[model samples]
Target: MTNTADHGRVRDSYDVVAQEYRDRIGGELAHKPVDRALLGAVVEAAAGGPVADLGCGPGHVAGWLTAHGAEVVGIDLSPAMVEIARREHPGAEFREGDLLRLPATDGEFAAAVALYSVIHLDPAELAPAFTELRRVLRPSGSLLVSFHIGTEVRRLDEWWGHEVDVDFHFLQPDVVAGLLTGAGFTVEARLEREPLPEEAETRRCYLLARRD
Candidate 1:
């Protein structure tokens, strides 16, 4: 697989710290069975049908979708993660691509999911990303996303123990809902709860949006 060097940068970042990421966020973000059940519900609810795990890293959700008989593709910015995904989950299609420029036709998906994926993108960056998600989702498609919500913006001074250059952005519930609405995703479900981390003062927000 030819790696776009730009894609290579993401690959390197993840490669440099893959184990660290897996350790830190992996357990905290572990929702394999529960996520599968919820995602299945979203797929069954959508008239267009099928679903995608947007920004799918290591292809966990994509693997579950495949097992559940959904036409699924896992997309991620990191080529290393993509490689690992393809290796680990042979049946699922794992592509190295940006969320902003999704490689799909308009209304191509019945659902789009991003679990703790947008934590790396700021509001400005996320607006266009949401636009892509909305663009590909069928009219009745739903988007379920989770992110670390906070009152203050946390610049990514580092990621998973690596001194990374990328900036990470956290959002409050209102701002996230506004972005979803602006991007043509009808905000249907929004929930806030305390994060699992003891030091985490912020809440974990879940948004379920459908195309309008």
Candidate 2:
């Protein structure tokens, strides 16, 4: 179960750092060839259908998808983040929403991407989150998720000089895959990579799944 208080903290923290976060991480895809490649695959899989960028901070991922010919909607928990995303990436739609209970209709998207976004969720919340993702996706829709690979929770009291509270929960790929499977998604592909020099020193895991 997702703690409402924790969710509020996460939202507030992101709201506090929304601008700085966008300035720093907005253009990250330019340096990540693998991430760009996977995102391209997502665009192709969508076949011009609308794609959902879940946990889309500043709308960078959604913007990239829109630039690549996919219709996109970006969803974030922070209203400030959504505002920045809308202002920065006018081509894609941005909305303030939670992962556990998305503000979208059932089967509303042909594909969805949740890059490094699920890390904010508690381990027990993963199943429900994935189930919600599946609920919003069309049958056989593609889903891509990425997160830090570990079994630890890293809490932050401050970010970019702003006082805040947030917890980033590292996860095991196998456990995530199992949770996805239990949520009615079929695991398709998995990739693990070392962090780039500019990124935090942690291994990252990406999982591609299809709604069934």
Candidate 3:
């Protein structure tokens, strides 16, 4: 899908599901201890720099970033989510924006993150998304992405019996790393973890990369 159309569809989906998304998604499971650990490790490795929480639904990750002392901005395609994020996390900044078309300038970010966000984009579309990510990042900028570790497209299905049409294109770790490399990001660390019982899936990964 073209970026414009893809973004529009994403906005529509999120907006259509906003209330249910917020009500049904998230918890100790959604925001897990492992996330804290991963963030701690990344922050320590960050050496103090700003981070952009791309596709940051309801600003949960942005809240975590603020608590951890990282300058952060949470951007999402849905204005409703942004509003909720701002209302819930009063101090944090939440913007209505598309990840594939960032409003940030080049070298403005020290790091970019998409926690369980990129799965919405298929592999063919990843290069451009990664390219857009590369555009806003400073040279050697850190990129951390997390997603369900799997093969094949997890098509629109009844997620928790909601019957919502959500598209997920899961990739093996190697393919993700390759996309980062292809986008001029050097892989710093790549990890796979078994999901907690409460999670939708038992396997996910964190890929830490540096723009070259």
Candidate 4:
């Protein structure tokens, strides 16, 4: 079961930093060629079907996907984030929702992307989160998930000069892959890469899976 208190903290913290976070991180994909390539692959695999951008912050990824010819719906935990996403990326849809209990119908999305979003969930919450993701995706639909690669939980008491409480959980690639498998997904591709120079120093992992 997911901790509701922790979810509240995360939602409030993100609401506090929504605009600042958008201004600083909105243009990240431009410098990331690999990320662009993978996103393009997702767009192609979606095959003109709607793609859900799970935990989409500021709608940048969803905007990028929209620009690349994919229908997108961006979901975030923070209402402020959703507002900013709607204002900034008018081309795509944005909604406030939780990962553990998404506001989506079963098999609704043809493909989904959860970039650096699951890092907020506790270890025990991960399996349920993945299961929820699987529940929304159509059979054979693709899922791309990215996270920091490690076994540490970094908590932030303050961010961007604002009082906030949130935790970022690093996870092992193998462990995440196994959890996806347990959630009825077939692991397809796993990629690990060092962070870009302008980004944080943490190594990152990306897993591509297919709903079975």
Candidate 5:
């Protein structure tokens, strides 16, 4: 189970920044070639079935997946974020959901993407988050997860200039890979890349895994 306080903090923080977050992130694909390519491959691997975008903020990623021919459903912890996602990507479905205890059925999706979404999860929630992800995927289903690569807890008192509370946890890639493996996922690929000059200084890690 997710800690209520922790979940509340994350929800409220994103709620406070929902519109600003959408304005800034909704068009990020225009500048992020690598992310676009990775998401493209993920959609291809999904093979035309439904894909879940966990922690989908404004639904840009889900929108991209929809354009690529895969059905997409975006889930976020904040209702405000889900609202923005629904408005921004009318073709795709959006709903409020917790990563550690997703409001989804077992084997409900053929693939799932958690792009930079796990950054908001505290250390203790990581294991259960991945477990819930695996539970929602069919056998041999794909999972594409990305996160900042480090060992730091970045606390924000405000976002988009709005007062709020949130903690962004940077985790080691190997540690996350191990967590996925222990959760019954077969780690297929891992990539680490230096941040683009216009982006944050922190390195990013992407892992592609499959439910065994």
Candidate 6:
């Protein structure tokens, strides 16, 4: 499911294209109303405690949380991405860390968000990542996860004219819910939406849950 090879590939791929990716996607929320609304709700549920934005690419979402009155820390697998995040959001904490083995102790965060962060993982690896997410949150802490909805792993050979190795795994919403349930999370809401004009055509899903 999760191998060091794939993880290294992901980190290296992102490192190679961090700047272009940041320039392209940093303003994405401005055109995504649904995402902004859901993220606002997540911040509110977090209630001012430290929130972990797992796989927080470039720290845009973490910046949004900070703008909305939440204390946030952004984590990513790519050091280049983390550097960009730190430059973009000086007020928020940014660190390089893996989702399967976060650099935090148990019950370290009050809430967590993983927006399309698990897309690189195979289905078998998702449980371990979810368990790691649970391990970092306090009891009853909230979690908001989003992902592409479908059954496909889009293997991207090149991005922005740069060669890269990455696979994006799209999952069914119900399957994701089952994964959360098995990881000791209580599913509170399931949301799905069609993509915007600037986005991929695939449907997107959001799941709000709480640690049990």
lDDT of candidates 1 onward, in order: 0.71, 0.95, 0.78, 0.95, 0.91, 0.92
lDDT of 6 at 112: 93
Model 3, stretches more than 4 Å misplaced? 1-3, 29-31, 157-163
Error of 6 at 199 (Å): 0.7
Model 2, range 53-106, lDDT digits (tens) per residue? Answer: 999999989999999999999999999999999999999998889999999999
Higher-lDDT candidate of 2 and 3:
2
Candidate 6: Cα lDDT at 121: 81
TM-score of each: 0.81, 0.99, 0.89, 0.99, 0.98, 0.98
Q: lDDT score, residue 148, model 1?
A: 78
For candidate 6, write residues 1-212 as lDDT tens digits. 36879988899999999999999999999998998998888888888889999999999999999999989999999999999999999889998899999988899999999999999887888999999999999999999999999998898889999999998999999989999999999999988899899998989999999999
Judge candidate 4 against the unseen true structure and give its global Cα lDDT, from 0 to 1: 0.95
Please give the lDDT score for candidate 2. Answer: 0.95
What's the distance in Å from true for residue 124, model 4? 0.6
- Residue 126 displacement (Å), model 3: 0.4
Cα lDDT tens digits, model 5, 107-180, are 99999999999998888889988999999999999999999988999999977689998999999988999999
Tens-digit lDDT track for model 4 on 1-212? 46999999999999999999999999999899989998998999999999999999899999999999999999999999999999999999998999999999999999999999999999999999999999999989999999999999999999989899999999999999999999999999999999899998999999999999
Model 5 quality (TM-score): 0.98
Q: What RMSD does each model have against the real structure?
A: 4.1, 0.8, 2.2, 0.7, 0.9, 1.0
Per-residue lDDT of model 3, residues 100-128, tens digit only:
77878788888878888888875678888
Per-residue lDDT of 84 in model 6: 98
